[model samples]
Target: MLPAGLHWIERWLPGFTQRAQDLGAVLSGTATSITAFDGRLQAATHDDRHVLLMASRPFLEARIRERVTALPNVRVVRARAAGLVVREDEVRGVRHADGVVEADFVVDAMGRSSRLAEWLGDAGLEKPRLERLRNPINYATALFERPTPAADLDVAAAIAVYAQGLGATGLSVASLNAIEDDQWLVLVMGYGQERPGRTLAEFRAACSELPGVFAQAASGAPTRDIATYHQGESRRRDFTGLRHFPARLVGVGDSVASFNPAYGQGMSSAALQASCLSAYLTSGPDLSVPAEGFFDLQQVVVDAAWSVSTGGDTERLEAAAGIEPPEEVRRQRQVLRQLLEAGLVDPFVARALNDISYMLRHPAAMADPALLERAAAATSATPH
Candidate 1:
């Protein structure tokens, strides 16, 4: 999976510099030309909106493993997941194939395939309400040799292809992430019924269809064949709304909310949820697990991610399902559409959007008094 922007994550998890010492540079306007609102290719950097770090999953995972194990009372275990352990409605621990391990508090960070709902039922607790937005997406990714660094560019190209919900098919990104070694971790994304090719010809065609920089970078050779991942929808189990849910247990990552991969939010959302858990542990009710408080904070994180992702999904839904988005959702889309159109021309809007996308600011903060006024002026000045 791709890594999130560094500023926020670096704040939470220090020592990134030493861990991924060879991490690549950020993709800013200064880095390479980027395709933005209405297919207008332009530079990607601004005052607040700039490139973040570029690192690979293995590099990050290794660092995380090292850091976590170094903790005073932390143990790193490799075990097959069986299910949760619970007494009445409070979760006590986990049950694996070999044996059962107990804990004062438990967390389920399993991804889209999590069986938390089934575990709850097995433990005689009511299952949380599950919500889903169907968006069949398929894509494949592989590592390739990194290109020679471009003149005047920081690292390499990171092209973002935004959909605006107009096309039934939306291109996600051409992320040619320059990583630790002289390798580029490139991912090609597609939506709805479209699928990334499998055969050599198909894969080459898919690569050629991406932005020029990505296509040229991958034109050389691939470390592996095209691999495909499929998911039907974005889902959330509404544990936060349950009054009698289990205590001493929390759901993180996709067990809580699995956003459509097209939005590239799964990891970032989980990190934000991790921060929420840390907040509760550090400051809130110490001994007794503040499960409710954690859920409350976690919900805020999920809501923001869901809004951004579902905003794009709803557009696809309209095309795929022939159902109209709610009036509020439509209005929000219209406002955001205007913002996107004006953002490239307006510096303030660009910074606001970049911060929101990077999770440094709340999505609702898109409506800041000054931002709204500036955006409106920019939109009005445009010849739409």
Candidate 2:
């Protein structure tokens, strides 16, 4: 099930495999008090290298804590940032539960509910205009121990089936995870036109309707009660255009933009943003350079994730209203549709699709002349 032509590429990137392993170790020690839960996981393959065989949030957090705790500059403080303490033209510090913590650089990793906007208001900075597109994505996900070894479960096979739904404008995926026990997280997802049910029984029925692999994976395995999450839309904060910004404060992760979770881009996007911020710090404290660079990098990350999530969103004809995509982005959408459809039968197309999904390749890779030609040829020969 490894997509054709991708194994070699994945061997180098290892896509999420190493990252997931690193994350698991850190989080295990960071959130040691709370019980680790398995709500959802991702399914991906990059160039057939098999990026991540299986991973869970608990594992990822443990990985992060183990690695990050050793860093002298990194502090795992248990408090929420309530506001920014800014003056005249720059940020002096951030206000947390304990009190304002003064720092030369402040990176907000506060997820979506960031207080940066209010803090910016305190500094004479214009709040980045926010545009939201509502798709009303809702789903009930549960974890179950796999009846067989996780090595027996195929991540690419599950994603290939999900890619088929993309052809019809729907989405579904079943992936393996290594928590306390080996397990497979089966998710039956519906987008605008194919959104899932709200109630537990309704969601269970939807799960039953998925490919036999899902039901088979869950069969006889102890299943947790379905937990539901509903995110109404995607929101992007326009930070790059702001001329007046605090010198010391910058936001990261979902604080900058929160995509529809169905695409599973949350953690990956956050990691990229964190890396960008880290990179900016090495250039010294110029403020303007890294601040602008931070937002610019964030926009790039958002654009990449938005392209895939919105392409999936568009299939939901009912949810398409009020969703205004930039007019210049036409080619990416067309290529994505082709990739999904082509991925149904062509392993090469699928490999390319996974690479793009995991942020391992630029969207332009989908437009390679040879790729387009193969996709076109595949579409002509294959019937939907």
Residues 268-322, candidate 1: write the lDDT tens digits. 7888888888898787554343378888899999999898887777786685677
What TM-score does each of the candidates earn? 0.87, 0.77
Position 250, candidate 1: lDDT = 82
lDDT of 2 by residue, 1-384 (tens): 112112322342445344653433111110111110121112222333334333556665564476567767777667777877776566777788888888667777777887778767766677878878777655556666655543333421243134433322244433323343555555555544455534555555655555445455555454566566667788878888776666767777788889877566777777776667766777574873338866777678778877777666654542345454565555666666676677666667766666776577766677799888988998888875
Residue 333 local lDDT, model 1: 81
Looking at model 2, report the run of 10 residues with the lowest lDDT sum: 28-37
- Candidate 2: Cα lDDT at 21: 38
lDDT of 2 at 27: 12
Q: Which stretches of candidate 2 lie over 4 Å from their true place?
A: 1-50, 152-157, 160-180, 191-204, 288-290, 318-335
Q: For candidate 1, what is the total of clashing residue pairs? A: 2
231 in model 2: Cα distance from truth in Å?
0.9
